[model samples]
Target: MKFTRNASANWKGTGMDGKGTINTESKILNDAQLSFKTRFADGVGTNPEELIAAAHSGCFTMQLSFILTEAGFVPENLDTKAKLAFEDGTITTIHLDLEAAVPGLEDTQFQELAQKAKAICPVSKLLNAEITLTATLLS
Candidate 1:
């Protein structure tokens, strides 16, 4: 199977003063605003790092779900939070916090699966930064 996705960005003016818009193939983001303030400071728009974090979180969680099912466990709930650190004009780290509930699953097994998911997930593989994961099994 193959999948293709596309997103476009347009910018006007200088780096700090320029304004940009981001549009994706899925249309979930249509002309989303992106500016220097948004990327550096607390601005009124979304930034690339924020979007990358969202993608990492979503992809990791979904991969974990599939891994659990394949291992004969059913995931009742899964919540993953991804944090991206951008410093010195480069992405430095990506951290993932995952909390999941799976009935009758051992901590050891869950931990192994979570780690595997973090290693094998497409987004995790694509990112060229330090990746850390904290997995908690909910009671």
Candidate 2:
């Protein structure tokens, strides 16, 4: 299977004055010079980490749902959070915290399914960082 999205950025002057745009249609990018914290990059605007978080959370939940359904269970609630941590001017790691409630399934079964999802999710497979999944089953 293959999927792709393209992004582009333009920068000038240095850390403060540079800006860019994100074009979803062109698979290109938006202004990213100021980053998310600054208005130069809109909060709702596009950046690599936020996009990665969205992908990870969405894919993880979907994969978990499918696996649980195949195991004869339905999810009560599923929440996935991804935190991208940077260090030394590089993406050091992406930490995932996932909580799930699957009715009619044992804790062991839920954990197994969650683990499987973590292993097989597309974003998880694409990232080289250490990904962690924390799943909770609530009746």
Best of the candidates, lDDT? 1
RMSD of each: 0.7, 3.6
**Please, what are the lDDT tens digits per residue for candidate 1 over residues 54-134?**
999999999999999999999999999999999998999999999999999999999999999999999999999999999
How would you encode candidate 2's per-residue C-alpha lDDT over 104-139 as one tens digit per residue?
A: 788887788889998999889998888876777766
Off by over 4 Å in 1: none
Best by TM-score: 1
Candidate 2: residue 81 lDDT (0-100) = 87
TM-score of 2: 0.77
Alpha carbon lDDT of each predicted model: 0.96, 0.73
State the local distance difference test value for candidate 1: 0.96
